[model samples]
Target: METFITYVSQNGFYIWEEFYRHFLMAAYGVLFASIISIPVGILIARYGKLSSWVLTFGSIIQTIPVLGFMAITMVAMGLGTTTVITTVFFYSLLPIIQNTYVGIKGVDSTVTSAAYASGMTRLQLLTKVELPLAVSVIMAGIRTALVVGIGIVAIGTFVGAGGLGAIIVRGTNATDGTAIILAGAIPTALMAIVADLVMGKIERKLNPVNKTATA
Candidate 1:
């Protein structure tokens, strides 16, 4: 514990910078994935026949080994944060896509029918009724992707992309690396926990039932 504290105090700036990089890489990946996934999810949900195929493809992509995927990407994108970001982006697709599909589909059917009968077009029904109710589930998927991304980003060190993993790697090379490892590992774990908590709050707040209760 003393060694961990001492190492952190002495190298706070370096560690802080790496921590920021780690988070940004993960955040950017999830952000980009969300942009594409949410729409695709909605599309599949509307066209239920497509749901199985799209989700199957996502599952296959998700199953690929992280390091292997990184290596495959590195050949084209080359090294550094870009490669790491690309890998994170691909890996983030499934959770966000799945959650969005489920969330949109889960919206009450009666409400949707009522909206359509009230002279709303497909776009209006989707935008006003479906999306509002589904946002929380979509957020949950984003949260999962971000948390997973944080862990995956640790492999960034091997790809020449710096993150907290770089610190942990440095510890691996040292004669006494336990404290150094903890310095990096602790922050990574804490970051995941914080991300999950914040996203959970956002999800709950977006939920209509919660809003009614609080009101």
Candidate 2:
């Protein structure tokens, strides 16, 4: 406890900066993954036939060892934040993409039929009806990706991408580094918890079922 307290007092600034770096790395990764995955998911949902192949490809990427992926990526991108961000971006895709595909597919057929009956075009039905109804499920997927990104960002340190992982790496290298490891681990865990909780609230708000229940 005393050592932990001392470490905190001494390294508070470093912790804050690293935490921010970790956040930026995770945020950019999740943001980019969400941007790409959601659209791809939509396309898959629309086509249906492509869903299996597209998701299988994403699953294959996820199955690759993270360290090996980083090592391979480093050969192309070199060791830096860019490599980390790109790797993390890939890591985040599956959840968001899968969720988005499921969400769009799960939208009520009756609602889509009504939209068509009302003279809505396919594009209009998607944008105005399907997407809106699927918002909650999509948000849930994003939340999952966000948490995954947070955990994975720590590994960024291996490729010279600075983050809370640096603290853990340092601790592992040091003779008495438990305090340092705890310092990083605690905050990273806290950040993931906070993100999950906040995103959960947002997901609930987006859920039409919840709204109807409240009404």
Candidate 3:
């Protein structure tokens, strides 16, 4: 307890800075992933034949070792935030794409038929009906990706990327730095928990049924 407080007091500004770096890394990765994956998912839902192949590609990417991916990307992107963000972007793709595809595809066929009969264009049907109904599922995917990205951003510190993981690595190198390890590990866990809870609320708010009930 004394050691923990001492560390926090001594490294207060540094800890806050690393926390911000960790968050920004995850944010950029998830932002890019969401922008690309949501559109690709929409396309896959429309063209059912592409779903299996695209999802398989994402799964294969996920199976790649994280350090290996970072190392390779670092070689190309030259070991900094870019490499970590790029690696994180790839890691985040599968969940968001899969969830978006499933959510959009799962809409009731009869409801779609009715939408078509009402003279809604393909775009209109998607924007006005399918997407609204699917937002909850899509948000769930984003939540999953966010949590994954948070964890991976810590690993990014191994490759010259700044994050709380630096504290963990430093602690391990010290003779007796258990408090140091907890300093990083505890904050990382807490960050993940806070993110999950916040996203859970967003997911609930996005649910059409919940909206209707609340209305």
Candidate 4:
């Protein structure tokens, strides 16, 4: 307890800065993944044949070992933040894409038909009806992607990317397993919890029943 407290007191700023840096990198990765995946997912959901092929390809990418992926990226991108960001971006795509595809596809067909019958254009039907209804599930996917990205960002330390994992590596080299575990475990857990809470709040806000029920 004393050692942990001492470490925190002395290195809190450094730890916090590293945590924030990694968080931003992970966020960038997720944001980029969402940009690519959400539109593609929506299109795939609208077109069955395309959904099959895109998902199959995404699944193949997901099957690649994370270490191998990062190692190759480190070589290609040459050991910096870019390698971490790109690797995390690719790692994040599968969940977001899958969830977006499922969410939009799972929206009630009757609702879509009604929108179309009511003279909504395809764009209006998609934006105003399907997407709003699907937002919660899509947000869930984002939550999943964020958590996964955070974990992988820690591994980014191995390739010269900085994070709480830096402390862990330093601790290990200094023969202090306690520091490694504390540094790695605490920040990761905190990020996961905070991400889940924030995303959960957003999901509830987007959910009509919850909003109306509260009102």
- Give the best candidate by lDDT: 1
Q: Model 1's lDDT to the true fold?
A: 0.94
Which residue pairs show backbone clashes in model 3? none
lDDT of 3 by residue, 143-190 (tens): 999999999999998889979999989899999999888888888899
Each prediction's whole-model lDDT (CA): 0.94, 0.92, 0.93, 0.87
For residues 104-197, write the lDDT of model 2, one tens digit per residue: 9999899899899999999999899999999999999999988988888889899999899999899888899999999899999999999999
Q: lDDT ranking from best to worst?
A: 1, 3, 2, 4
Error of 1 at 97 (Å): 0.8
Candidate 2's clash total is 0
Write the number of the candidate with greater lDDT, choosing between 1 and 3.
Answer: 1
Candidate 4: how large is its RMSD? 1.4
What is the Cα-based lDDT of residue 215 in candidate 2?
93
Q: Model 1, range 1-215, lDDT digits (tens) per residue?
A: 89999999999999999999999999999999999999999999999999999999999999899999999999999989999999999999999999999999999889998998999999999899899999989999999999999999999899999999999999999999999999999999999999999999999999888978999
What's the TM for model 3? 0.98
List where candidate 3 sits over 4 angstroms from the true fold: none
**RMSD to native for every prediction?**
0.8, 1.0, 0.8, 1.4
Write the residue-wise lDDT of candidate 4 on 123-210 in tens digits: 9998999999888888888988898888888888899998877777777777666855587669878997899899888978887667
